[model samples]
Structure formats: structure tokens, C-alpha cells
Target: MTGVNIGILSIQGDVAENVSATRMAMDELGIEGVVSEVKNPEQISDLDGLVIPGGESTVIGTLSLVSGSLKKIKEKIASGMPVLGTCAGMILLSKKAKDRVVGEMEQPLLDHLDVKIERNAFGRQKDSFEADLSLEKIGISKFRGVFIRAPSVIDIGKDVEVLSRFNEKIVAIKQGNVIGTSFHPELTADLAVHKYFVTLVQKKN
Candidate 1:
């Protein structure tokens, strides 16, 4: 079996950890593939899937736009490229992003996922917490999710499905081939999330 080629957006934040988790997941699944940091849009090609890691959303988005990667990302997503966004990545994918303390910031977004998000919805870094996510709707139950300065899904379009939740708030969601979460799955030893994302990538491939 030809392994899936997964690329982690290396623009900023948790890139190395994501890449490691993705590789580990693939190994556990006995899938042959490579996971590496992708800094340019040109690397978008031949990638079975892409991961937008946790980071400063505004900075990553602005840098992507400035570096001409925003359009490429949009194009890939529009063409049905499977993507998994976590943490600040959620803000990049969201069509609407608001601040929990403030309200909105001037940040360029890929605008692929149809949802409204609130940055730092969980408060400060000290408010970072872990919870057993209810992702049973997607055949996953009790996923240990780590949320750090995460964003919350306030509103989503009808096409979006709630994959997981915590404290009555939407944390994990799926829309078509795109999967987004408010937590950092890579930070945990559990590889289920990455494994699931790889499955999505395989299906799309």
C-alpha cells in the first residue's frame, strides 16, 4: 500500500509536534507515508492531507497571505483536499472569528470552514484544561483533548457536524473532508485523532 503523504503547515506553532504525531499515527496504523513540515504552497502538491497546527492564528494567517500561501490553501481546500485544523488553526479555517475578550481582529483567513469562532474562549493559558471529549457521533469516544488558549466553535453551518463537545461547547467539528478541533491532539500520547485524520486523507485520495 502506498503510504499517505501528510503535510503539516510549518508557518508557525506546534509544527514539529504535529509532524511527529502524524508520523507516529501512520506508523501505528501500519500505513506507509511521510510527514514533514511544509512551508511553501508548492509542497501542497502530492500531499494526501494537510494539517494546520496550533499557533497564533492572526500571525499565521497574515504571514500566509503575505507569503502568497493563503490563496493556495483556499484552492486546495476548494478542490477537496482533506485538512485537519487544531487550536489556532481553527481560527484560520473559520469563516468568522471573534475574540472572547474583545471581538474581532483584522486577520486574513482561509475561510474554508463555515463556522463562527471565538479566540481564547477558554481564557488564559492558565485556563488550559484537559477533558474527555465526546466524539462518539464520529465513532470516537472519550478522546483526551488538551486545550490551550483554544478557540471555541460558536456557530456552524448546517453542513457541519458536531464530532465532539465539552462543557456544552462545540470543540470538534467536521465539514466534508475538513476536520477541526479546539484542542491539541498532538500534545497527548493518544494517536486516535491523527489516525482518524489519516483515514479521511486516505478516503479522499
Candidate 2:
């Protein structure tokens, strides 16, 4: 894992937290790597893996698009750059997104991940809550998932693997090396999910 470069899309959302979590995960795994904030296309191209943190999907997408980072991210992911998309980041990674209340959303998206997402599937910010999740795919069974205005995967491609669910709704999913979660694993104390993603980066690069 030496010299592996992992970047957190830092246009918005949990930039600092994701950076810290990824660094801690790398340390915990004894993997030598660089984790930093990435906002432009040049920085994105340098990443072996990426973390799109939880935040307003539209805002993040728009900001990235302004600097042409959106297209670069899609290209990287398409080229097998492992990415971890949490909460709104998950929605942005999907092929399509429909807001439960507003129906369709006209927002910029990476649209490389093969899934249809329902925005705000868990209600609004007021409905935010935390729960114990069983994420056996990532090796931790008793993971505490933090959800905040989370989106769910209502439809997925055949190759997509369901990692976890909440109230029978799809919450966490993995399509190849790309992982999308409706909850915020970076917001939790446990670093299992981040560690798992780091290992994937290690293997890929």
C-alpha cells in the first residue's frame, strides 16, 4: 500500500472528517498512503481511490462541475478507481436520482455507478437517526450506521451486491470496487468500512 493516493472530494460535506477517517484507516491497516482533499480535475486524476463524503448532493455536484471535476471523477471511477460514496455522495454516484417528494432532480452526477437512487428516502434532516448495522461484507458485523437525510438504492444492476439494509430498504451496496452507502460511516467511531475501502485501494493500485 506504499505510495497509494486516496483523495476525499472536498467541494463540500465532511471533507475534514473524511480526510481524518481515511488517514486513521490507513494507519490502522499499516498501509502507507496519502489522503488529502481533492477539488479539481488534476487532483482527482492523481487518486488511486476517492471518498465522496456526505453532504448536499446538488451543491457538491455543481461545485465540482464548475471546475470540470465531475467528468474527471466519472472517468476515474469508470477506469476502476475505487470510490466510497456516503449519503448524498451515494446519490451523486448513481445513474439516476429521484427525490421522493419532488420526483425528479435535475442535478449534475457522476452517473457511472449502475443504480437508481431515491433521494431523501429516509425522510428529511429532522428524521436523521443512528442504528446498529450488520455490514458483514466489509468484515464488521456490528457497525453503527449514521444516517442523515439518507438516500436509498431502489433499483440496482445485477452485479451490485447489497451490503446492508435498513427497514428493508437498500442502504449499502457495492458495484465492483465502488461502494455506495446511504449512511455516513465516516461519521461513526468505527473505521472498519474505511479500512475495508483502503484495502481495496491497496489491491487495486
Candidate 3:
């Protein structure tokens, strides 16, 4: 296959780790790809797939909007660009997000995924932890999921496919070309999720 260009939204979060993980994933899958950090809107045009890593949703959304990249990202996603959104990235991709104990949060979002997420559904930052996730569709039976101030999908649209659950809460889901996870896949050595995402990009190309 030709070299697939994968972009990681670098407005904030674990950008370098995602880049490394993605590159490793491509290599592990015997695929050709270049992983790059995307900080400008123009870069979205050359991307075969995008990853929004775990970070502060408000900060990521605000910076992307300020840099004029948010609109471009939405356009690309609308045009079938595959995206893997983790943690805060999942929040940014959701149609709605609210505080589990407080109420709704007024953060800027991509609003492409038709899921209602509960911000900090797992717990606060201090409560961050890792657990084994069973994502059968992606062919993983016990993938380690690292959650840090993660959010949970409280509601999902008809088109959404629930990939994994923890404590009966939706932790991972897929909607068309978009995949959202409440945990950070890059934080672990297993690259199953990243490999799956790279395959999505490969298929799209």
C-alpha cells in the first residue's frame, strides 16, 4: 500500500505518544504511513485519518477553534475521514456532554458523533486507573484501557455500535468512520486500537 498520512490533532494532549503509537501500529501491521502532528487547518486536507488524543476538551476545542482548524476537521470528518478520539477527544467528538454530578458543560465540540457523554463519569483525575476492556468487534478480548478523568457514553444513536463496556457503562463506541474511546490506547503497549484505526485509514484510501 502507499504511504497513508495520519494526523494527530496537536492542539493539546498526548500528541507525541499517539504519533509514536500510530507509527508503531502501522509498522506492526506491515502498512506504510506517516504520522504527523496537525496544528493548522490546511494540514487536514492531506490526512487519510486523524486522532484526537486525550486532553482537556475545553482547551483543545478552544485552541482548534482559534486556529481555524476545527471547521476544517469537521469538514474532513463529514467527508468520511476516519478518526479515533480518546478521552477528552471523545468528549469533543460527541453530540453532547454533561457533568455526571454537576450538570451540562458548555465546551466547544465537534458534535459529529451521535452520543451523549457524561464528563468525568469514571471519576476525577486523582481516580485515574487502568482496566481490561473486551472489544470483540476489533478482535480484542482483554485490551488494557487507561482512563484518566474519562467520560462515558450515557446515550448512543441508532448508528452507533458499542464496542466495549466497563461497569456497565459504555466506554468505547464506533459510529461510521468515527471511533471514540473513554480510555487512552496510546498509554498501553498493545496497539490493537491504533492498528484498527490505521486499517480504517487504509481502507478509506
Candidate 4:
């Protein structure tokens, strides 16, 4: 498909990295598109797909909520606009989130992805690590995962499919057009996941 427009939630996190990866993914897939950093509801309404990059979940969610972008995103996702949420982005997309260190706390969340996420499931910032992950659902037999203060899926609805795992922990999951990852795909060089998302957007568009 041509003129596929994608956006990265730029309220917080790796906006530049996500933008670059998305552009690369679109180019690699030979899909003509514009990848922009969007933080307002108006900018979000035009997106074919969106990437909620890894960042501070609380801050991102709160800012989006205050700016009315969160509601707009939920509406788009409900309308079948493909969304890829990485790390903190995954937390915001979840129906429930509890930080392992502090348990559950009030936070604005999109609550569109039907899963309960355990924030900082691997420990704290110092515990961040990378590993080789096999995301067979995305046709990736082997992929490098960059986990930094990542969140893991502890509970999922019937529609949710576990895509990848590490140390017996759920790191990646998908429910229809919504994809969530506990690792940062943009931080890595692999384009498999991003390219797959681009194709998903193209298919939906």
C-alpha cells in the first residue's frame, strides 16, 4: 500500500529511535509512508499505525491522558488501527499494570490491550539486559531483544497470543492488530518486528 502514515507517541521515551526504525521499516518494505512524532489528538487521528515506544509509563500515560491523546488512541485502536507498544508503551496499553517493586498504583492507561502487565518484572534499571529471542509468530526464528526496566505479561485474555518469552517469562504478546513487547525493538538493529508491523498496517489500510 502507498501513503501509509505512521506515528510514534512522542510524549516521552525513544521518539527519535522509534521514528528512525519505523522509517527504515517502511523503506525496507518498499512502502511509501510518513513517520512522524505525534503527541496530540489531531496529529494522531491521521495515523495508519502507531508505535508507543519504551519510556516512563506513568509520565507518558498521564501526559497523553491530560492532552486527550490517550482517548484518541484507544478509539483508533478500537477501530483496528495497528499499534505496537514496546516496554513502557506495553504497560500503557495493558488493562492492568503493577510494578513489582511497588505493587499496583493509580495511573492513566489506555487499557485496550487485554493483558495484565508486571512492571519491572526483571528487577530495576541496573538489571537491564539483552538476549536472543525467537518470535516465531512474526516469522523471526531468532531476534535480539533489548530489555531495559521492562514489563512482562503476567495475565492475558483469551485473545492474547504469547509471541516470545525469556527465562520462562512472557516478553512479547499480540491480540489482533495490537502488539506489545517488553523489550525495545527500536533499540536493536533488527527490522523484523517493525517490518511486520508495517505490513500489518498496510494490510489494514
Candidate 5:
């Protein structure tokens, strides 16, 4: 509550949107915390939780590695720090990724979550769409999900828990301290996902 600090990887993507949604989620839950955009590796140390937003995975991964933040984030996640990764963020957190429309892609990934993801599995940027998800584990029956050039989990390891699915495809998953979603929860008015993530942070803190 009091000393909770959440960071959003700001290398690219919906950095501001995630921050705003996180702050709103904290407020709605009557929790106290600070949400900030994290750019440098040093910023990762003080964070109780982290959010990797939806954006270009290649660019975000390249920039994070170059800045040395990728290693730090990997270390933090391995150390049991709660993380919420959306869309491209989900790709980075995945153990492996392949481009469904384009073919195999060689990109940097944290590989924290034990799941195989298919990049652009939902379609291209123009194919971005919205759907309602039933994340019963997170206490939500119908949550609006925004899919923008999204990826879906094609394979999941035993440790991974499928949170939500679309058309029988895995769209959201959780494993220990890491949460990954192919859809962008920050793009919608619903704060359930963020709130669930905040609870993860709170439990960790």
C-alpha cells in the first residue's frame, strides 16, 4: 500500500496509457502507490511491480537491451517481482515467438513466461479489434478486451495458467509473478486486469 511503486517500461508502446490505467486501478482499489515510466536499468531496482506495454516488440526489445534494462528486468522478474505484460509486452515475456503472418522472427525476448506465442496471430495492425473476455480467475465475467496487432499463445507449459481465451485461442496467461495478455487491457475502460495486477504487486510487497 504505502511504499508500493510500479514502473512501466517506457521504451515504446502504450506507456502513458498503462501508467494512467495503473494509477486509476490503484485509486479504485483504495490502494496507495506511485506509477512511473521506467527507461533506464537503474529504475527497475526500486519498483515493486512493472508493466510492459503494447508496442513494437522488436524496437522495445532492442532498446531495452541496449539500455541494459532488459537484463535488469529479467533479473527482477526471476526474483519474483510481479509484472503485467500486454500485447508486445506479452511477446517479450514469452519463451518463444513466431510471426503467424510473416514467418519466424528473430527478436529479443525476456522468455520469463513458459509459453509459445505467435506474433500477429490475430492479424495485422488494420485487423485490430475488440472482444469481451471471461477471466473468471480474476473475478471478472465479462471484460472488454482490445486486440491491436495482437499475439496468441499457441503452446503453454505446465506452470502457466490460461486466464482468458478468444475463439478457443489463449489470449491471457499467468505464471507465478508474471502475467501476460495478448490483448491490451489498458486500451479499455475496464480496470479489472490492472486491478488484478495491482493485487499481485500488493501481495509481493
Candidate 6:
């Protein structure tokens, strides 16, 4: 592929790790272009796809809103830019977020994915752990999912397809060009999810 530009939103999250994983995934596929930690609206427009890494949802939402990237991101997603949101990123992408540990406050949400998410669905930081996710529906054998104060998809709209589930709760979902996961795929060595996302980007391009 030529001139592929992917960005990992670095407002407040696991920015560097996602950048490294995305770059590695693109390199593995022999795709050449740029992988950057995007923090500004201008940088966002150059991106073919965006990755919102797992982090403190409240902080990420508020900071990005104040920085003016939140509105830009919402616009880009509306214009059909592919996006992958993991962990707290899922909260930002969700249409509604319930069960917030902290009291509800105004936070910028892209509302790209038609789902209701519950923040800290996997308990607190001490409850964080790794699990082998069976994403058979997405054609994956097993994915090592890292859950760090993750969010869970409590409800998904009819247009959304449940990609993977843990127990009875939907943990991964895809709707059109948007992908959202409750666990962190970048935290693991597997890059299938990221590669799958790139393919979506390529198709959209």
C-alpha cells in the first residue's frame, strides 16, 4: 500500500504502546507510510484510520475536548474514517456509557458505535488480568486480551455485530468501519485485530 497514514490518539492513554504495535502490524503487512501519535486536528485529517488506545476515559475525553481534537475526530468518523477504540476508548466511542465508577460528568463522546458501555465492567485496576478471547466470529482462533479497568458493551444496536464475548457480555463489536473492544489488543503480541482494522481502512480508502 502507498501513503497509508495511521494515527494513535495521544490525548491521554497508552499512546506509545499502540503506536509501536500499529507500526509493527503495518510493517508485518509490508504496508509503508506513517504511524504517528496524533494530538492535533490537522494531524487527524491526514490519518486514514485512527486508534484510540486504552486509558483513563474521563481524562482522555476531557483533554481531547479542550484540545479541540474531540470535535475533529467526531467529524472524521462521521465522514467514514475507520476507528478502533480499546478499553476506555470504547467508552468514548459508545453512544451511551452507564455505571461509571465516578459520578457522571460531561465528556466528549464520538458516539460512532451504537452501543451502551459500562465503565470498569471488569472491576478496578487490581482486577486487571489477561484472558484468551475466542473471536471465532471474526475468524480468529484465540486472542490474548488484556483487560485493565476495561469497559463492556452492555447493549449494541441492531447494526452492530458482536465480534467476541467473554462470559455473557459483549466485549468486542464492529459496526461498519468502526471497531471497539473492551480489552486492549495492543497489550498483547497478537496483531490480528490491528491488521483487520487496516484492511477496513484500505477498503474505505
| Reference-based TM-score of each model | 0.96, 0.97, 0.97, 0.98, 0.97, 0.95
Superior candidate under lDDT, 3 versus 5: 3
Candidate 5 C-alpha RMSD relative to the actual structure = 1.1
Error of 6 at 72 (Å): 0.8
lDDT of 2 by residue, 81-196 (tens): 99999998898888999999999988999887789999989898899899998988777789898999888999989989999988789999999999999999898879999999
Candidate 1: tens digits of C-alpha lDDT, residues 1-205: 3777899999999999999999888888887878888877788765789999999998889898988888888898988989999998888998999999898777899887889998999899999998888689777777899999889999989999989878878999999999999999999998888999987887777
* Best lDDT among the predictions, by candidate number: 4
Give the Cα-based TM-score of candidate 6 against the true structure: 0.95
Evaluate all candidate structures by whole-model CA lDDT and list the values in order.
0.88, 0.91, 0.92, 0.93, 0.92, 0.86
* Residues forming the 10-long window of minimal summed lDDT in candidate 1: 39-48
> 40-95 in candidate 3: lDDT tens per residue?
98988789999999889999999999998888989999999999999999999999
Error of 5 at 66 (Å): 0.2
Q: Summarize candidate 5's per-residue lDDT along 13-68 as a digit string, tens digits.
A: 88999999999999999888799999998999889999999999999999999999
RMSD of 4: 1.1
- Lowest summed lDDT over 10 consecutive residues: which window, candidate 3? 122-131
Given candidate 5, what's the lDDT at residue 187?
89
**Tens-digit per-residue lDDT, 69-170, candidate 4:** 999999999999999999998999999999898999689999888899999999988999999999997799999999998889998899999999998799
Q: Count the backbone clashes (under 3 Å) in each candidate.
A: 1, 0, 0, 0, 0, 0
Best by TM-score: 4
Q: Give the CA lDDT, 0 to 100, for residue 109 in model 1.
A: 90
